[model samples]
Target: MSQSTLVSTRIDKWLWAARFFKTRSLATNAVELGRVLQNEQRVKPAHAVKVGDILEIHHADQVWQVEALRILEVRGSASIAQTMYAETADSITKRQQRAEYRRLHTEPAAQLQQRPTKRQRRQLDNIAID
Candidate 1:
């Protein structure tokens, strides 16, 4: 069914359909964990989400503030999912800035190619002892 025809859908279903979470259960879990807000208020997974309602979704290290443009119940193509919500300008800017910062600053653990060599381990132990 074309999602645009629906007046409203469950928040979890909408989140999954919009591709915010990988599955409906994940979306529900996120809602229960207080990672999602509807109109600035915490809502249950079954909460009804209508077109034009604002949503704040926090996933991983990024936060999204978007307005629902269509009510969807089924997951769809990425192109179709992108059509369902319109992110606010501030949200877009914040996400971009965060992405840039992450790009510029690498994760410390990411530098490790493998387990430490014996010499490296000994050096680490020596440093710890001192």
Candidate 2:
């Protein structure tokens, strides 16, 4: 194959094609913001990536560790996207653990019914000072 048909592609584009980001701009922003790390180091959006390179991506409340397996220029179906990378076992375990923890603990904000009255607020402040 000619060099033009090679599998090498930009990291950001691959991220979008792999369904990690909804849009190219979002993928680009993630890289610029340092949420996407290649080989344990931050990389630019245009950084070239090849199969077998490890990518650490921080998305939402979890981090994903995936090994790139293919490079394409266009986004495809979710199943096809999944084939682009293989997630690490450690990442899978940590994600499941975090999900369980979140399920058990829930969000603290969810426990609040309404705004505290002034008297209750004052009581809270007083307790903090002790």
Which pairs of residues clash in candidate 1, taking residues 3 or more apart in a chain or in different chains?
none
Q: Name the top TM-score candidate.
A: 1
Q: After superposition, how far is residue 66 of candidate 1 from its true place, in Å?
A: 0.5
Compared with the true structure, what per-residue lDDT tens digits does model 2 show for residues 15-99? 9999999999999999999999999999999999898999999988988999998888788899999988999999999999999
Tens-digit lDDT track of model 1 for 1-130: 5645799999999999999999889999999999999999999999999989999999999999999998878888999999999999999999999999999999855776999889988887898899
Pick out the ten consecutive residues of candidate 2 with the lowest summed lDDT.
1-10
Off by over 4 Å in 2: 1-5, 111-130
Q: Candidate 1: minimum summed lDDT over ten consecutive residues — where? A: 107-116
Whole-structure CA lDDT of model 2: 0.91
C-alpha lDDT of residue 42 in model 1 = 98
**Model 1 reaches what TM-score against the true structure?**
0.84
